[model samples]
Target: MATRCDAIVIGSGQAGPFLAARLAAAGRHTVLIEREHLGGTCVNDGCIPTKTMVASARAAHVVRRAAEHGVTVGGPVGVDLRAVKARKDRVVAQSVDNLTQWLTNLPNLRLIRGHARFVGPREVKVGGETLAAPQVFINVGGRALHPDWPGIGEVRVLDNTSMMTLETLPEHLVVVGASYIGLEFAQMFRRFGAQVTVLEAAERAVAREDPEVSRELQSILEREGVAFHFGVRGAKVARSADGGVHLALNAAGVAREIDASHLLAAIGRRPNTHDLGLERAGIATDARGFITVDDQLRTSVEGVWALGDCNGRGAFTHTAYNDHEIMADNLLAGAQRRVSDRIPAYALFTDPPLGRIGMSEAEVRAMQKPALVGVLPMSRVGRARERGETQGFMKVLVDARSERLLGAALLGIEADEVVQTLLLAMQADLPVSLWRRSVPIHPTVSELLPTLMAQLKPLEEIPR
Candidate 1:
């Protein structure tokens, strides 16, 4: 007999687990499938593990400056790479185990461990066992894309997944992208005493962000000893006789050679669309291989939905959680949800982390809106000076006529936390006057909100 389910979720990643749990809580017979670990890449290879490494790097960085904190160490501060990896593994395992135990207790949800392929519409075959469900959700996430560079396969190269498993950090690590993953790993390894160099094909790193933010980040990274080769159109890699990798970068009609102990390919990510047999189920995918879904996340085929990285809908774990929330409501509560034109916030966890919500100055101008821009240096904030993190700035843009916050960009300590407040201001259509009137705790970075507002002038009078 084919195992039947009220709802079947393929790929037990962020979206899959989330929706499955919701469905089971709603008393639906749900089954979640996973070919590997339960927590998916975020826990196993992506967010959790990467953040753990960042925490380790942060500890090392802080310990080096412990003297500034008036703490005297008796001996030399050192790190054991083996112990770090051990702790990372332990953390990953504990989270996965907790999730497994929680899911196991849900009587309405069954966990299946095997590779699944579409046998037909509404039917999947897992290792020779056929399962059927009326409604199916595809949530397989993305994988790091490895570009075709000559001699790449012959040399020691690592993708985002393989990079996190490093027992001993490389002496010289070359990163091949300027995206979030590339930038974060490059800095972390460099802080761990590796010679780190970032190669970006674009004119600037983090091109998706505002130019000012990118420039500030570049300055910070360069000050911290990470070298960047920008405007490189292509690269060729060859193995040196001494076990190092030689990279020939083509930029400005010239080729330059760089040697590094290991190369990291963080160019981008590709949706895991193959082997699931989308065509068998009569589903459609975009040219880039992302599954196409309507506003409700419903695919062309009825009773089928796709979410998370597989749908190419902003590859963040939080977005996946949101997708699950909206998807469950659409599925069970008969609510119509559309993921269009949302006020999403993003953070780049570099030194003096960068965070942003909504449009940039360029974007606002290109859209032909009169944008009033305001900026205040972190130096002006009392807390920034006291905490010795007076580098960077806070900026806010408001529509000239409506005085509501159109966007905000923060680059400094606690940027990740501060961005949420900005997000709320934007969502609630709050004005800069409100921000000015609100009193934040004294001697805190949050007070920079009013500090920035004090420097604003109307955009109408500014001469172009």
Candidate 2:
């Protein structure tokens, strides 16, 4: 027998629980189905757990450099990998418990724990039960991609999820990508007293960013003894007779081999849309299997929509939550909102984090439009000097005619939080002149923004 509901939410990721709650609060019968843990990837493996471990790594880094700050420790600084994993587990468990409790107690909402598959239009099957609703929402998140390299099945390899389960640190950790995930783990393991080496097929790290940004970030990581090999190709993995991992890599037609204690593949991620039986429901997906959706996040099938990493619109936690907001406002609140209306913003959670919003300098230059540009080094920031953690720079671009902020990137201490101010101004379509005239607090990294705006100049070729 099919159970009729007002709304059916599949995969309790960042979007499902909240959207289901909204439907239930509106006096509609709602069913939320989750195949995995509550709070999806963010709580289980992605943001929450990774950032918690990042914090521990930062603590280890700080203690190692305590001598420079005139603080003395009685003994040598060392990180217990087991203790770090325990702390991360506690943080993640607490979040999952809280979210699960709230969803369980919510009125008029049923929580189903099983994999959901589309059976027909506006209907899904989980376990032996068929759930039919007028509105169907899919919020299934993504997972780390395991490359089908030769000999991959013979040797054990760690992805992002498996990396969190380490009790003992590796002696030599070889990372297979120089992307965000790979770089973060490289530095984290290095700080924990492991020899870290990163391999990237591209010529630079984070190829999406400006060339200078990539070079500078690579330089920062290299300074910490994190080895990097770019332009790598023809990579293969194998198990050594001595119970170790062996990697053979080719760069510029030259073969290179490395033996390491552990290997982590952090190349990319893919949506969890393959097994959902979308073909049964006539739902459309991209070539890469991401559910296709309009600007309003509407899928091809009527009364069905996809959110979170499944939709391929945006993958971050904040963006996923915002997706629920956009859809709920349009459907329940009788307002017209769109995913495109929001500006793109995200952070790379390195020790000296990278906060970026809007267009990159390369993007602006590619447009060939007149633009006002500003650049400032973290070494010049008062707060960075006080903390002895200066490693990056800030760059901003504005429309020359309107003086409106086009984009900004802050890569220094506290850049993750401080960049929000610029995001707000850009969201409001405010002018840079307003920021230049405003007085900002002293002894802070953000206080330099006003001064940076004051130095806006005509765009020119990047310095040699």
Off by over 4 Å in 2: 461-464
Pairs of residues at least 3 apart in sequence or in different chains that clash in candidate 2: none
List candidate 1 segments past 4 Å from native: 74-76, 458-464
Provide the overall lDDT of each model, using Cα atoms, as 2-decimal numbers.
0.85, 0.90
Write model 1 residue lDDT over 1-464, tens digit each, in one string: 78888999999778899899999999999989899989777889988988888899888888887898798877776777778888888999999999999999986999999888887788888887989999999998989888687778778789989998888879899999988999999888888888999988888999987787788888888887999988886678899999989988786567889988899999999998888988998989999899999877889888899988899877888777788888988777998877764687788887778888888766777778776888787788887787677778898888878888888889988888888998988888787888778899987788888868767866555443
Query: What TM-score does candidate 1 reach?
Result: 0.96
Residue lDDT tens for model 2, 1-464? 78999999998889989999998998999999999899999999988999999889889889889999999987988889999999999999999999999999999999999999999988899999999998999999998887677887778889899998999999899988888899889888888889999988888898888887788889988998999888898788899997778888886567899999988989988999999999999999999899999999999999999999999999899999999999899999999999999998998888788999999988888888999889999999998999998899999999899999888888889999899999999988889999878888999888999989999988875552
Q: What TM-score against the true fold does each predicted structure earn?
A: 0.96, 0.98
Prediction 2 global C-alpha lDDT: 0.90
RMSD of each predicted structure? 1.7, 1.1
- Residue 191 in candidate 2 has what lDDT? 86
